[model samples]
Target chain A: MNTKPKILIVDDKPENLKALRKVLKDLDIELVEATSGNDALKATLCHDFVLALLDIQMPGMDGYELAGILREEEKTAHLPFIFISAVYTDNLNVFKGYENGAFSFITKPFQPEILINKVKFFIDKHQQEVALYELNEELKNANKELDAFTYSVSHDLRAPLRAVNGYAEMLNEDYGTHLDDEGKRLIENINYYAKKMGALIDDLLAFSRLGRKEIQVSEIDMNEMVEGVLIEMNKSITHNAKIKIGKLHQVNADYGLLHQVMFNLISNAIKYSSKKEHPIIEISSNEKNGKIVFSIKDNGAGFNMKYADKLFGVFQRLHSQEEFEGTGVGLAIVQRVISKHKGNVWAEGNINEGATFNFSLT
Target chain B: MDYEVEILIVEDNMSDAEMTIRALKKNNLTNKLLHLKDGAEALDFIFARENYSDRKIENIPKVILLDLKMPKVNGIQVLQELKSDERTKKIPVVILTSSKEDPDIQECYCLGANSYVVKPVQFEMFVKVVSELGLYWMILNQPPK
Candidate 1:
């Protein structure tokens, strides 16, 4: 009776309770018995029950009144109640039972098979509701935990990375002459990887921040952003080639995020073109379908179109490590930036000819 | 051609420290070498007297090699501490790190790191940096003696 189901069986005769238990024992259910309506009402108040089998005839509180009281209480109101009256199956009794929150009626000389099936239906449905309720709460808590963890990573992880890079650089300058060529290069690589890892962390943080940061859409000058990106790009891109600056159009977008988009697209053009014989980079933007479309084309080691779907995936690189150098997050960041601005990004390329990236802001 | 440098090398990794020392030595400037592991140890070495009570305060190495990533004290905090210290206040601290992260480089300079150098991964390049640093800090420039 006090098992998993937490069922409340109310009947004046103990014989009826014993009979119901014998029939439902095979099903994994807990049965609780109350001889009178008063006892049933008291039991429902203290414990959660999947279903209550109420006896219509009772001494102090009648089944209808008790059921009405249970229905008034928010806690036990939704519990499925089955009324047992022994009184003939009359329309008035059934209508009143229905009005008082009785799910259905069961005659005193109950059919064991029919009762078992009906009780099983309600019990299974109740278990499902409970499972769903618990799952929702668990999911909410997990999301909150994840948010806190990301915040810690955004701040704490960077301190150590900075230290690794700072001291390594000092070693290079203060001890350069004393080291052999290979020795110097080793430290430089360490410095490089540390920087690479640092960029990875920053990109991850930026992507996470994008979810919450308010996107302030304003008119943005793509030409100016492109030029600024070019200046920054010049610092790291070890490439010598002809870069043609096309006419850029202004767009209604988040200025900072759009700048990031342009920077990523343009620099990617230069990086992929590092090995090109005549590396030519073209930047142009236009209004397409009422959206500002920006494109960056480059003559470089292009990727196969079959793998095009993976282009914007975080840390997804199609090329071998020896062929290209990057954190593989540039395109992903660009995608995020554009997506945040209510835009779309796509890439077109062949194996060796070149690659062209296009994005639009709406 | 000689120079006495108040140099601070802050480095966390030991192998890098040894390599840096080797490079500086090869450049013929091994008379002064101060190696501190983490930021906390570096601060204690430079600021607290009882920390390095066994060593002479006057003979503090002209250059301090500082590593940024350490358990307690990190490179930036150490730089801030050194710049603020009267005794080792003017010492030229160079940041040598394995990271090419821009913010790390920018922050080091902002915190008064004298020079920022990215450690090259290849052995040959690392040796070149070490030698250049030795030549620059030891033989080329003179510090306030």
Candidate 2:
């Protein structure tokens, strides 16, 4: 890898190219010189130049024409140029040079300091852009690796978990008469933990799988969706909470993902507020700041405000497993789904008071 | 190699194969079951080549419970080879693997797999799934003669 930045200097006169080289000699760069416009185009093909210094008074192809041709090429389209002109030093000619996409214009008998400063600016800008491009490529590769890891976990990790659970069940089934009560209890514990681990792996896979799933947007009736969630929850859970649902606005979003979001939020609200006597749960939506903000508020064991930021993180739980039986992936999944839709999710809570989970869809 | 086979299970994982056999045994469906270790061996046995050269190729199993991920050759390749062959094309192949990936499922179906079932992690669910699959394929399904 050539770490030194390349600069192309083009002029009709060899002396002029020499003068530009003498000016840029102090800078740490590789200079490629061309005496004609055609040669400059050829030089661009050979090297990825950070900046091009062009003389405007060439015979066959002038500086402006060369710059225009360079701009047309995809590789050199964004290449910055310093236009040097002895003939077109006037305001009109300078304006024409600027129209031809000149980064900086220098009149002939140009000061060495001025040329060096302008060359240095573009080189710095090019270096910054290169750094940013490298960073972006690294991030893309990292995301790909994470997805592959999650995929393997989904496929390979569950096999061992299934084996553990299966053998324990076989032991219990085949030798239940021979084993004592304590031995049977131990086998049961093994099965229980294996099942719990299986659930955790399933939740983790679901969360990671969301990253790769493409969003298919459609107009969803929020009222109907919430009603469906409530009906399903009522069937599965025995909760005595007083539920209230306000008019939810219809929004364009992925149906399956949004349904999951609603399910997670509403379920969290119900579970957290289950211990409260006469627990009150409210589900509402309204348009604010050109976004439909839907909220699920519950009067339950509200978390401390200090740890609110940690609520949506994967496996991040403010409450222990004893207080709430959860895998802690629900909110993380909610955040991922909402963010993928280009929306925002947040929560407000205080100790012993209540918690309100809100999300906005555009 | 010479025994009467009704169900052929091609699975590389010993534990998984054992559990599957136990599940089938519980339902009295393992009497004529044959378990091959990998796709290569399964292919050899089905084509009546290599070690099982004495077996007749015309004696096809009623159901082949195939695992997707295996050494030498995978389930998709096995499904492709079987479905493309005239003699083995009629045999029902049920893809039993741990992968629930959409692409894998789609590819299996595209390769002419009769069924695709994700292996459940829970022991009881695994047992139930295996037994039900055995009962359905052995009893309910009428194979082409």
Best by DockQ: 2
Q: Pick the candidate with the highest lDDT.
A: 2
The C-alpha stretches of model 2 lying farther than 4 A from their native spots are A34-39, A56-69, A89-102, A177-185, A213-258, A283-294, A338-345, A359-362
TM-score computed on alpha carbons, candidate 1: 0.50
Tens digits of per-residue lDDT, candidate 1, A122-175, equal 988987888898899999788667756765575456555655765676677779
Binned by DockQ into CAPRI classes (incorrect, acceptable, medium, high), candidate 1 is: incorrect
Error of model 2, residue A54, in angstroms: 3.6
lDDT of 1 by residue, B41-87 (tens): 66666664556645544544555656665667778788887787677
Worst lDDT 10-window in candidate 2 chain B: B1-10
Best by TM-score: 2
Lowest summed lDDT across 10 adjacent residues in model 1 chain A is found at A154-163
User: How many times do residue backbones clash in model 2?
Assistant: 0
Q: Sort candidate 2 into its docking category.
A: high
Model 2 Cα lDDT, one tens digit per residue, B35-113? 9998998999999998988899999999999999998899989999999999999999999999988999999999899
